[model samples]
Target: MFLNHSREVLRLLTSLQADLLILEENELLFFNYFFSFLSSVLGLSITIWIWMLNKKQNRRKDRIYKQLSGTNALLIIWVILMIISRFGSILPIVLFGTPGYDNHLNLYEEYWILFVLIPIVVFMQSWFTVRLVYQAGRWIFSTFLLCMLTAFVLQLTTTVSQEKLNLAYHQRFERDYNYIDQEIRIAKEKYGIDYSEQTVEILKKQVTESSVKQVESVKKAFFGDRPVTLDTIILQKIIIRNYKEGGRYYYKRNAIENWRYALPIDILKQLSYFDQNAKETKELLEVLKEMIDLVNTPEIHWQEYQNFTETERRRSLGARYNIPDPLIEQLKKVQTRLLEDDLYSDFFKNLQAIKDRE
Candidate 1:
């Protein structure tokens, strides 16, 4: 029965080690799993040897005492090491909040309980096995009760940790989506573009997808397989510094610009349905693309005037940059077609207003 139980434990441990090895890309987890497995195997071997010594009849008490003395000495040294490991694992999280520079230590903290549990379980099993030789029923009941209690504690801890993790994930998702929605709202106010139902749906879908990807990226940085690279490390430091200095608004502004650029392209493409001349439409699309790029450039800033109209500001900036006459003529053609469509006339009008402000 003892041998069968040992075989089962070995099998389970082997399976777990194999599963962990498959995640070897995560070097920190790999090493933690390796060391924990090594310690468990060592502990189990020592227990088996002690059990064998107990079974010997010749010089039984003396032999058992000598063997147990050595085991106790080893256990004391292991306990000291475990304490140090546990302390090292927790100190970084208390200081940094998350896995920052000392990811190895953080990973150890994640599994340190497992490391502590393995040796303890082994020692308890050894004690119970020896006791069973004399008080079989009592030792058996005690071992079963201890196992149940240990399992219950472990399950409770896991459940609470999982609930906390889920809550955090949802909060992050909501926060990111809110940021994206704010940019969209600003765009709507500036452009006066009464988005059609279809267009609104498209924008929502795209924004949701983008937000999910962004959140996933953050999750990966926190808890995924981290590869060490100089560029990545530098980027992480920059991001952390930015957050500390309240420069996170920079990301919000960047998102605003990205959506600002994307919205016009999509709206313009949809409005192309109003123009039937395929050739002119193609040319108009090309010119619109060029105009969007030109207007977005830093050099295209509108000069303030006491009573400058939107068209006047555009022409002045165009001349200042020495924009070609042909490009200007093509843009005027686009403006005329856009204004002819009652549904999107306000879109082009507000678009010009944005250019004037820029």
Candidate 2:
């Protein structure tokens, strides 16, 4: 009966480890279950193995005492190393609250360390076997339990660290978004940027529109159970950074300028069905893309890159965002014509000139 129980537990551990190895990618469901099972086995086996080894050592005066002393020394070193490595990982989660999915994988990848316990347990049982009074023939049983306990503690630590970090990251995003929205509202009020009643009504209608919902429903119909999160919105910031880094200031500035315009591109598309010019919308997007090549072709300036980085650093430090000097000069030229009642004809003419040259 005892042997059957041990065999069943060993079989279970083997199956879990196999699932872990085959998954190739980290899925939280499998990771949690595998670690839980491994931990329980280690805790049980360690206590039994230690008690049996201590009993055997009591009988033999010379050899058992020397061996036990050596084992104790090795165990102390093993535990100290484990603490140093693990505590270093958990400290950041505790301090900064930036626990991420990556951190979880990093903490638990040290799973192979449990195998070391196997050799230690076998050596203890062997010392007793040589003395010819080995009543407890459960070396395998003890080793498996010891492995489970070690795994349990490590898995627990990782789960706690990851949970802490995820909460922190989510809260940080919400806080920052709320603060930026408030700042925008304050700027709008200070500038006295009031709109007509009809314009305000259109804006309200856009807000109530379900364009995003319709697109998502279409996507879900084709792609089953795909998850989406704030990461999607965060990707736009990454795209903006990429454009700046590549010195595509014309594209980057125009994209940012869109945010300051009458309505967002998506909302404009929805509003287009009601008096919005299709040709103008197409021309705007076309101009945005063409400006990228024009800016890159006219020789990317080092000062523009320097100013872009400086602006980014200041914004991160909570400064008001501003267009860099090089882009500001282009805007000044465009605005000068607008003030002169040129009706942006010069802007289109210059863009045409660049296109003709290309």
Candidate 3:
């Protein structure tokens, strides 16, 4: 009998809790709809009030108010709309937390009635009101509207044409083939090494193959197509040239003066392309892999040390003060290896010699 009574009490409590939750949810939903409706109404009212005020001022016999043109009225309404749209949601979020799920619908659908439809209606109203109130000729008004539309179309066309021309220029003469051309030009001018058309064609083919391979590799790893960005394309080109001509070519021919100073992140990212089985490529890749690891490795492990005040640290030379960063230690060893290794040292010396002669 006592067990049956306890079970009944538990079921009642659960049912009451569920009812409370449902009530709270319904209240939240109601508030959301109410706020959205209120906001929409407020925006529409403000727009209509502005239109009315502009009309009243323009109708005044006083020269100051009479001088208010239709363009000036339109500009005023535009400024008001911009301000409201920009700042309307900020106050609500600060005071009432996040808006309802329907807030987007309110913004996109309900607010369109306020922002687009009302403004358009206001604009047409102002247009006809100005004409009627001022007793302006219909022919003059029609000509003014036609002229504005024509100027807007012309400006849009010019902007679009300029953008297309810039895109074409970048594609044809500045991106892929142009890098090879510049390399050829530099060799011809500096070393008197003239490449024939056949040589150029071969170089272009090699670059195309390298670029396609790199793009595919990236897509396979990331599960996406190559990102349409100039920096990504340029980095891939640099990697291709570095791989084909040997890593030393970048240090010798490219503006990068030191192998150590080259972007470790870029080298680490492209490390998979360098064959670790090959003797020539192994050392550079190994060094770059170490550098990337060191970059990500923390300088200090704070959790290893006991928590102590600044004053405590000043008095005691303990484990905290004695701890040496592993990254710094590893970096020193890598630097020594780079300086001593013939693969890097000899190439750098030759580059320095060439620069000295130049």
Candidate 4:
């Protein structure tokens, strides 16, 4: 049990280390941009389709499907399609996307309903109302209840909550924004940048600054215009340093960092999107493939290489041919330094940048 705990701790630390080295500011900025870019066009298309798709009458094909009256042929297929559509959104998002906070938008994909289940839903409801068909109501209601029970049970283990199976679902609701209002409590905390309309409006109107006595420390470490502190490896700053240290060989680091934050290229820059049809969407997928490539590349283990070459003093850098590599000793240092360079430290540092930008 102790060993299992130790292993989990080691894994989490390793992941944190990896995330620190690789997650770049630009890529995050880019991702936001890409998300926006895709959203605008996709949203417009969805709106248009929804507007056009809406009809007072049941769709012809949906009517056909509803007309078939058999437990085997009708109920089976309708149920199968419903199950597929439910999983298409609820299953995948609940299963994988939730924990990572990935692609919640997929949980809202139009095809899940636009082409299939929604029309079926409309058909079933309409057929019963128009023709007063109440014969299959027993089976339909039973099947629906059974499916809901099954879904609720399965969701317990899914990435999405077995209980709260909604994407736009707020964990809790607050009607008032007042920090001390009777109805509103700040609670312990909230999420990443509150870009909700009200918050964005406020941010758009103000800038906050902190005048630090040891401002020079931050400047040296992460800011440019002077030498970088060991921790402050900015892209433009690093590009200049890369040329000085090992030349273009280190350029890949820039690419990797940039790619990580790039999110989506045109989106990152917030470029013009004159084209967003099927072809453009296809091209976007290809760009995503390239981004995945960059995400997979491992961080360079310069220390490992140095440790390997300790026997050959001439080949190694950093404090001569290097001292004996002690795993226990280095791990202790990692734990100690983690206290110094904690998550809040970096999170606030970039947070300041976002504030500055506003």
Candidate 5:
């Protein structure tokens, strides 16, 4: 019977492990639901077993009854002290804004003394006396507490482990994002193009305001006494706006439409269109090559956008901008030619294989 019970317990525990294995990263909602249900079932089972064990012991009527002795009082005192010590340790953690269950194992470590004394308390108590019901109740409550605490500890471990992995992933993402930003800046500098969010906002204000003085004030606040030509301002506005909207149009296919609004494409087109003279065409080609490099970058994963269907690309954030179809077609042709000659041919092909579900 003991062997069968042990096997049953082991099976339940194994099932719980399997449930935990299926839980994905940062998914606390489902994790809590499963953990709570399993622990409750386990706790109730143990509580029932303990009640049955106490009932069997109740059959022994020869068991002596005694008054609350010094040893009992001393044991109770020790238990109280153990609880106080545990709470004392936890208070600082709570005050510092850490959740009580964040480090569930710490509860065990802090109150190990209390757990050691529980069995002793059970053995010393008189099972035949009126205290039998109270003792059973305490046992049931303790069993439930241990079961839930174990579940909480396991949940914490899984969550913390996933958080660490995500931290590393985000760190790598930021590094790649910064690298792309730097490349975009260099390309803009090469073409004598200057653009930023502040600049765009400033230009918008200037366009809306009727007062020339207010516009000059805004320009001075941004540029700080530097002379800026109206042509330069218009070009900067175009470059900044196109880079952002165009990037969303050409790339960011895998991302949600609303979220893709935050992502701006590289300033490749702005540099290409800055000076279309024959003398600058060679330099323009270099800028185009840089754009191609940005697109093919394995780290940025821009292929996801390239793999997007014509409908998806056309339905981008900049779809309303109505970028010239001729210019768009020419850029695509140049990009295709560049990819054919590039060493990362395999990478580009892999991108093509990533068909958009949309």
Candidate 6:
């Protein structure tokens, strides 16, 4: 009888856990939709380029081409649908821009005009390129030939370069995401962010504000006060660290990967856009400094010392005077405040109102 009651309790716990996960999973969907959209963009771009390059209109080849016509249609349709899906995916956020499941998109809208233009351009380019390919030896329209050749080369280079860039981009994206995830695990386990319900607007503002100021500081240091040569050296170091450290600390990657963007966090909080007196500001400046150090080093990851908590637990509160007891907890409380803010709710409510009006 006791075992049966225990089983029921465990089952209830599981269900409750799943329900909570489902609730929190909304933020994660943006990454999914974006990654899918990027994949489609890259895939369609490559397909269109290939079709444009290979097309020919000779009679015998046409007959042979008819057999492969289904393949071409399939490819074209795939590209078109993917494009449409991506466009459809982004519309909710940019237009009405709701949050959560009904939102069905991201709060931070990422736009690409190429999504609409590519399909139309693809078909047109395919038609023209087919004619050009067949007339390579003959004199086709001079402008048509020039345009065709240029499109051909441009398409080839763009597809190749985009793939390489996306490759680097995704690698860094995943790396930084994992890095943030690692930190979150620390935040939850060692600190107490996971337990807090106070996560909301002020928290978001803090992170966003911090990041923007950090970037702005770097920009000013490089372009405003420091010489171009000095900035170039810093940029070179950043690039080298990106390559060497697998980008554990880079900004475009690490900074963006943060679940809570420091820029918007700072913005919402109305923190100083720039800290004029970094030397004097102790509490706030220290946090900013850690972030800046992370950005600059581009290699050093914030790692919680293994057995840190365990070691802490072994001692009494005042048993260890050297280590600060509240520092770890203080850091975690700050993190929690960032996560559970009411800002998104207010933002979403306003957006939905506008959407309803429309």
For this target, which candidate reaches the highest TM-score against the unseen true structure? 2
User: Mind giving the per-residue lDDT tens digits that candidate 4 earns over 144-235?
Assistant: 45444543443233221112211112111111112112211211132111224432222111111111111223223332223222112122
Each prediction's total of clashing residue pairs, residues at least 3 apart in sequence or on different chains, is: 0, 15, 0, 12, 1, 22
Candidate 6 residue-wise lDDT at 261: 18
Instruction: Please give, for residues 212-270, the per-residue lDDT of candidate 3 as tens digits.
Output: 34434432332223222322333333333322221122333222222222243343334
Q: Sorted on lDDT, highest at the top, how do the candidates line up? A: 1, 3, 5, 2, 6, 4
Q: TM-score winner between 2 and 6, please give it.
A: 2
RMSD of each: 17.3, 15.9, 23.3, 22.0, 17.4, 22.3
Q: TM-scores, in order shown?
A: 0.30, 0.35, 0.26, 0.21, 0.25, 0.21
lDDT, residue 260, candidate 1: 18
lDDT of 5 by residue, 131-153 (tens): 53344566545654665566566
What value of lDDT does candidate 6 attain over all alpha carbons? Answer: 0.33
Error of 4 at 150 (Å): 3.4
> Candidate 2 residues 241-320, lDDT tens each?
22222111244533443222112233223223322233333333333333333233332245565544432342332111
Candidate 2 wrongly placed segments (more than 4 Å): 1-136, 142-164, 175-323, 338-358
Residue 200 lDDT, candidate 2, scale 0-100: 27
Candidate 5, residue 52: lDDT: 37
lDDT of 1 at 224: 28
lDDT of 1 by residue, 1-358 (tens): 2222332233233222121001123443344443443344344445445555554545667567546644654564476457645544344234322212212334444775765565565545455434423544675466445555554443333221123333443343343335435544643575443434543332222123332333234324423233322222222222221111110223332232222111233325533443544433433343344454454433334344535533334335533443333434444565677678775465456554214323
Using alpha carbons, what is the TM-score of model 1? 0.30
Candidate 1, poorest ten consecutive residues by summed lDDT = 239-248
Model 6, position 325, has a per-residue lDDT of 27
Count clashing pairs, candidate 3. Answer: 0
Model 6 lDDT per residue over 138-174, tens place: 3324433454455445433333112333344334234
